[model samples]
Target: MSEADYFKNMKHDRNDPNPFLAIFMDTSIPFDEEAKAIYLRDCSSKTRQFLLPLLRPLARLAIILLQIYKSVVPNALTSSKALHRVLYWGMKTFVSPSANHMILRHFYLGSEVLQFIRDNVPGVDVTMNPLKPTNLEPVKDDLFLIHDLNLYNFIINLNRELRDKGLEVKKRDRLNFGAITSTRIPIEPMPDRWTNFLDLTSAIEIFTPVYQMFLTDNDFWRATNSLQLDETVGLLASKIIGSNDRLALINNKHPMVPLTTLRAGFRLVLHGLATEQLHALLIELKHKQEHADLSWNRG
Candidate 1:
């Protein structure tokens, strides 16, 4: 089916026990084998296998340091323009053009997914007002900001709903990021055509380790179980571009989940280390390719 038609016909039942799972079971799309191959190679690389165990202690230490940093610089982790600027420069300088496109596309995709959940799921009235994507010129900083605000609002709103359901996802008492602004920034509609170098499942596999490291155990479980974001994203992805395993992996259990949360945490640390290595390699390859093109043009 065409992309536009897919979204038009997308349907979810509010009465379904798990709307995300139900949606995926009812839909099917073609798999991108090239993207799947890249994901599999990175996940199974010998370098990653060797370093997984070694990174556990370092990951623990890093988490402790992160807590210390958060205490010292309370606003550092909070959503702000300054943080966005740093991220913008980092992406422009180090990330490949294809990777940058994928990253930006993620913001748009995420916004749609969140909106879908809010509208279809009962009792999920998240106070999100994302800015329109009118122009991609200013390096799409506005789009990034909108995505961040949407995520922030979604979490805050979802937490409130969970509290009403008697499942408190314990958090810091002083963790308030203040009220969300009502003003909306204008943006253009998503382009009709864009390169798809990376699929959603691959992107999820790449970032799951980093997410596991950053989030506390309770918060992580609450996000996965209570919010069911994984299933929602998996469903959204499956409908657009099918996962190699189809909907088989789209469930309540996290792909990284192990015998215990503790073990899962350690395994994720290794995964993060491997991801870093892979990212560095990509950056280097990008630079080399650019240099080769420059030389050819000069000659």
Candidate 2:
């Protein structure tokens, strides 16, 4: 189904607007070229700006290396399983308990990203740190459903308005609460060095709140199991990739796109995405008002 059709199915009060919507929606935020230029000036780092572009090429190389590792390493390991078993037995027999603890510490880094995103990102003004992730918090189950419905209704109405203006929004098959059967994914707590930037952590911080603002409020209910940074990030990232991919479909065809160039910059991208979402919320509200007025006149 088209995004508008899918959104129309969302549960929300058609007559009343939620007051707390402002926490997620900021219609006043600027997203034009002038605002983007200013964001670059305030938030850009010279070294990062230079090195960031290079990552695209490195990403390609990493993919190749990963393919080779998966293909070659598995067979090699299988061939060496007997030797490995002997080595494992010898190591267990010889290695002390204290030595194992030290080895684990060497592999385990602190969960700084989780702590930083949860404790710091949401409370900070995005205008100042546009790079930070949208703040997502665990809410009461009842509250989650209410807000989720509100956000769903807002998007549905906004898409209808956009369609009236001759815009085409495609169906996005990204992750959502209704579609999600399970939230079990491999949790790699330590991200690759390439993604271990402050901007990534900041961007991740915004994921939950941004996602909740867009999808069903109860979409993150599965995450209540542990709220571990890796698992939560995994859930959030899946939705984010889905949302971005949906936007990409529109952007690919349209001559003018939002946040196309600066999207490579983590902070800039987060702001651009959040700005678009907030704009949708405002459009939805306006459409609701217009409909209300028409109904009143008809009465």
Model number with the top TM-score:
1
Per-model TM-score on C-alpha atoms:
0.37, 0.24
lDDT values of the candidates?
Answer: 0.40, 0.30
List, in order, the clash count of every candidate structure: 5, 5
* Residue runs of model 2 more than 4 Å from their true location after superposition: 1-43, 73-249, 252-299
The deviation in Å at residue 283 for candidate 1 is: 32
- TM-score (C-alpha, index-matched) for candidate 2: 0.24
Candidate 1 lDDT over residue span 184-264, tens digit each: 213333233333223322333333334433444443433333223344344433332222244443333353443333233
Model 1, position 213, has a per-residue lDDT of: 39
Shift of residue 137 alpha carbon in model 1, Å: 5.3
Cα error, residue 56 of model 1, in Å, equals 9.8
Q: RMSD, model 1, all Cα superposed?
A: 18.5
